[model samples]
Target: MKRNIVIASVAAAALLTGGTAVAVAGTQSSSTGAPTTHAADAAGTTAGESFSDAAHASGTTARASFSDAAHAALKAVPGTLDSLDLDHGARTTWDAEILGKDGKWHEVTLDASNAKVLNQHIDRDTDAEDAAEAKALRNADVSATEAARKAASSGTVTSVEFDGDRTPVWEVETVKNHKERDLNVNAQSGKVTQAPSDDDGDDD
Candidate 1:
């Protein structure tokens, strides 16, 4: 198990180095552990706005856009932003994080086009999941946001992940005109170069 940095106060919460949520603030508020929340897209927004600004706009989409979205999703979270990543996966989304909301950290993904939330997950710094995720983050040549933008040439990116085989690679999956394809991007080189995923779906 990977150890988290020592957390003494909320002020020190947002200093995540590797997906660590050193502290979460509330004892009374209950959160749905890793919930998949889907709501209608925010209406009447022009394109090319910064994700942080768009999330501050309004409604359900407001519940899941950028920093404010992460803020409202939970009762008490960190004040500082750890990492903000943008991607075209699942409709041009922003995957961002804030640290030490009590003993857990928050990650909220939002659609850039309409400012819709795709998913949200909270993790304690001590969770085993954080270890793997942190490793994946280390292996990436580009953010999921960039991979998704590149993926558009293939099709609409449905999802992305850092695949750890002998090396780190971004597994970008896409669907275009009702067809799907999986691509492997070199984490170090940021190239869309790798053989297709094996039949068993393993990178080996």
Candidate 2:
């Protein structure tokens, strides 16, 4: 009878030990899986933050638009805009020429990124041709802005300059589908025409 009891006790202890081992193994697996899930979530969050930071940097480095630079030039000069050009060299800049009410031409330079005026000067070396061009411009019915809007029907206008060659016109340069186009808009009748190409086969 004693031997039977001993054998039964030994069997119960073995069963209990096996059950404890299984419970311990289950706890270890659950703990390990939890850390892996947390690591994956953290990695995802870091990647999202990196993308957002890159986007912000790109936005900060982009140049200002054409309209913004024109507005800034007008605000600084407070005159009739004659020509505006985007110049790229060591630094990108917007060069603006304005005819003031005092019959003098003002040249203004602005930073392309923030539209801040960098330099300005009055042109005192005016001649008969300058006076004639200014007079024709003032007498014209259409303005530079109107000419640009009319030219924009063809493509995106990049620059506008007063061309006083045979007839008073606003020369507008545009780009569309990666092709550059030069258009001349009449300052009086608001007529648009193709500009003559400057390349006279000098390379040939």
Candidate 3:
């Protein structure tokens, strides 16, 4: 009977010690949890931080951003800026439409954060759409350049295009800290205003 008691006590002690070891390990594991990914790496940007703020924070400006994009697009194909826009997604894309050397419109997208040229595509074969866009552009007294400048005041302009409406407005897309937004400027007046809505998500 005494041997049985001793054996049971030893077993109970072992169990208690094992449990204590596990508890210590768990505490250590939690205390040294893996380092968190940065907002830039995770592509998680805060909302409401203006584009100008983010750009300034990142050591850039709205004018510089436009200049960088224009330089990159023009370097690839010397052309005039046709239109502009900002693509919202995992990253804010600075997209510019340029009437390229080939005399075809080229869509160029840049990384708003770094102003790295992302992609360039020869936008071709949509004659009807092109005509409408051109007509809208002509009717607008406000240049895409002016719209971009105004947009950079609130945030980084990612894009500028004529809204698909009868009385087309300049659709300006901007981003700050990765949060995307669209603003509208009266084509004739250049009065900037919040857009009524965003367009369908970009295919890219």
Top candidate, metric lDDT = 2
- Candidate 1 — which residues are off by over 4 angstroms? 1-105, 109-113, 118-121, 125-129, 198-204
Candidate ranking under TM-score, highest first, comes to 2, 3, 1
Give the whole-model CA lDDT for all candidates, comma-separated: 0.39, 0.51, 0.46
lDDT of 1 by residue, 1-204 (tens): 222212111111111111111222111112432212222221111233222332332111222222223223332333222343334332444454533334356666655444355676775434566555454444344543444445445643334454544576656554333344667766567688645546758656
**Which scores better on TM-score, 1 or 2?**
2
Candidate 2 per-residue lDDT, tens place, 1-204, comes to: 000000111101101100001100000012222100000000001111222232232222314334455566766765566776655546656677766655677888878566689999897877777877666656555655566667755544446677665687877765443345788899789899998877854666
lDDT of 1 at 162: 49
Sliding window of 10 residues with minimal summed lDDT for model 3: 19-28
Give the CA lDDT, 0 to 100, for residue 71 in model 1.
Answer: 29
Higher TM-score: candidate 2 or 3?
2
TM-score of each: 0.42, 0.64, 0.51
User: What is candidate 3's lDDT per residue for 110-172, written digit by digit as tens?
Assistant: 775555777888766556666565545444555555555556555444455655356666666
Clash totals for all models, in order? 10, 0, 8
